[model samples]
Target: MSPEAIRKFWSLIEETQTNILLTLDNDALVIWLSRQLRREEFLKRVDTRDLNAYISERLPLIRDLAQERLAYQSHSSG
Candidate 1:
């Protein structure tokens, strides 16, 4: 897709994520998980935590979003 379209897609997701974060009362588990993702210090805070598993669980939405964006671009480009 064109650069503008790509930017717009990112913008939409950023806006969506932002709105979701703002409107929903994120539970404690989600907050902790998000912190685990964001904080380097927290990575070591808890022993016996499987960070990879956490990463794996969180990766699909990112992959799906990218795949969906690519498919949409392909359809529009053809």
Candidate 2:
């Protein structure tokens, strides 16, 4: 990916993260994030050629973080 594309991709990830945090909408968050990552990974791998491998490696941690975020949102909302 070009520098501009890289910047845009990160910007989008940041925006998506912010939206997820602000809305606490778990369903949409996961789907949207997945789609975004898939699209970017398909166009050009972010850091490696095997994007799925990268995702698989990070998935556990990502899941943990998402669960934690959901828990926090649930507790805070109530």
Candidate 3:
């Protein structure tokens, strides 16, 4: 992807993360942060060969979803 496309992709990810956070309470955030802390350690101790395969599969689904969303927006606007 070009730099602009990569930046846009990350912007989308950040937007989704922000929306998710808007729905979460502070207590829930603390709990989620605790889990994430554990996951950092867990990752260092585990094998991750399946991670790449899973991402390869999910990436196409994400791409198709974005395409469908764009099409819907275009159709609605027109």
Candidate 4:
């Protein structure tokens, strides 16, 4: 994904206030993004415990919003 898209994804995560991530399926895409966002470099920049909790709590919601955004972009550009 583009940097702007990635930024927006994280922004969505930050905006959400639910635990959708923990309830979602543990598929490749979810796992990959979770691992990427949880890297040592990124974790070091924030409160590790809080960040993990926030991401786990919001990932699914963030994914849903990201997909919606992508679909909108695709349709608009076509």
Candidate 5:
């Protein structure tokens, strides 16, 4: 993937709602991310056709990010 594509992908991940990221199971999360990345606006901003492969490869990291975010939220709120 191009550096720009990688940056955009992470940007999309960061922009995604925490609930969606945290609540969805792996399959559902992949579906959700696929749909999101396939949207016209996303496509217009970045070429994501090649990103499908990256998504599966990075899913574990994505889930880890969600867990970290949840922990941070809990810690901050407590």
Candidate 6:
């Protein structure tokens, strides 16, 4: 993925993390991420198949990162 796409991916992850109600199962999360990625202007030229594949592959890592982020935030705040 390009730098812009990577940035946008993290941004969306953070956004999702912030919105607790947006928590979704693995399959639904992948679909939601793919849809969000497609809506990005910077990612418009990228193939949908590639984007979906990329997100699917990284979903576990993404969840880990988001969980870590939340833990750190809660720890720091508390």
The numbered model that scores best in lDDT is: 6
Worst 10 residues of 3 by lDDT: 46-55
Candidate 4: give the clashing pairs: none
- For residues 1-78, could you state the per-residue lDDT of candidate 3 as single tens digits? 334433443454334444343344544543443344334443333334343333344454544555666677679999
What TM-score against the true fold does each predicted structure earn? 0.31, 0.46, 0.35, 0.44, 0.76, 0.75
lDDT, residue 12, candidate 5: 82
Backbone clashes in each candidate structure, one number apiece? 0, 0, 0, 0, 0, 0
Best first by TM-score, ranked: 5, 6, 2, 4, 3, 1
| Per-residue alpha-carbon lDDT of candidate 1 for residues 1-78, written as tens digits (9 for 90 to 100) | 334433543454443433343343335334534454434443444332454344335444544664566677679999
lDDT of 4 by residue, 1-78 (tens): 335445744764554433443345645345545555655354445544554555566656666775676677679999
Q: Order the candidates by lDDT, highest first — what do you get?
A: 6, 5, 4, 2, 1, 3
Worst 10 residues of 1 by lDDT: 17-26
Per-residue CA lDDT of model 2 for 11-69, tens digit only, reads: 55445543364454454544555567657644445544443443445444555665676
Estimate the lDDT of model 6.
0.78
lDDT for model 4:
0.54
Candidate 6 clashes between residue pairs 3 or more apart in a chain or in different chains: none
- In candidate 5, position 7 carries an lDDT of 76
Lowest summed lDDT window (length 10), candidate 6: 13-22
The per-residue C-alpha lDDT of model 5 at residue 1 equals 61
TM-score of the candidate numbered 3?
0.35
Strongest candidate by TM-score = 5
Deviation in Å, model 1, residue 57 alpha carbon: 2.9
